[model samples]
Target: MSPRNDIQNIKVREERKRQIMNVALEIIAENGFANASVARIAQRAKISKGLMYNYFESKEDLIINIMLDGFNQLTLSFDTNKDGVLTEEELHYFIDSSFETLKNNIHFWRMYFMVLLQPQVYEIITPYLEKTLQPFYETAINYFIDKGYEDPIAEMRFFAAMMDGVGLHFILDPDNFPLDGVKKKMHRMFK
Candidate 1:
């Protein structure tokens, strides 16, 4: 058999890292962030303690990556073309996709909101999340400008807050969430 190439090796590493993060997220969701530990996560992931460090510098780093990835997953549906502006179609898509993501990743979202509820934990992640979401915010603001809003920044803030509230409500009550109704309303409102 041929030896694995660099690309294959990179894929392997990425998958392993993802596995570790998934386990950490599950542990956090089940036990809460404060109770989750590196040793426990590593055990759950079936990786040695030393190897876990290779993927994550520390528990905080792992948690930060999961949080950042969760936000990025939502933002990815926005500005799909990487252009500075967000079109109406993309705006609609973003709203729809955001709800879909919440429905599909309840555990991660639950853990995400749980972490944010604790002031100290939220403080640890605030800077990282702001940095990651900066570009997303810029594109959204540009979208509001294109849509002819008088105050694009305020418009952007409103959009963000709306999304946050919807997500929190869904996580709090997925079974009773009017997910489709909310998505349709958002689409209509945005368009």
Candidate 2:
């Protein structure tokens, strides 16, 4: 194939893969992972199961890819600069972006929590979680230390745990939860 055709083919393949993943995310989020069969995802995507298989090896593969993509995007939002260092302003940005993402993409958050609650899925994703989250963890700890915290590690842990709690409540009761109010409070505390 010509170079132009090759580029076109690559773009088409990427688009199709993204479509399959998006459908998979919706199906899995709405019906739980056990009910999100290849047939169901394919039906939702308006593609043949055979074609879906062409893009992903199995449902497990598809879910993993979706998670990896979602997490990478989340982390990227936290990282306003690609410098691997978290400034005070960047930390605030991360908190704001994280809340916004969680509020807007509740389906993805549900899918994540559902997967975490499943031992089978959790085991499969453990390595990916470590690899993807390690950097952010390190950055948080280092940022605390740089700010001259007496116990940087504990400070980091507390901050992270608090954020997780906020996320859980936000997911469970988004309509009633005062997300903006909580965000402003957190900003003041962290700042």
What tens digits encode model 2's per-residue C-alpha lDDT throughout 22-112? 7787777677788889999998899999999899999988877877887786677665786878899999998889898998889778767
- Each model's TM-score, in the order given? 0.91, 0.85
RMSD of each: 1.7, 2.7
Cα error of candidate 2 at position 150, Å = 3.0
In model 2, residue pairs whose N, Cα or C atoms come closer than 3 Å (at least 3 residues apart or on different chains), thus clashing, are none
Q: Looking at model 2, report the run of 10 residues with the lowest lDDT sum.
A: 113-122
| Model 1: worst 10 consecutive residues (lDDT sum) | 114-123
lDDT of 1 by residue, 3-69 (tens): 9999999999999999998888778767877888899999999999999999899888888888888
Flag regions of model 1 displaced more than 4 Å. none
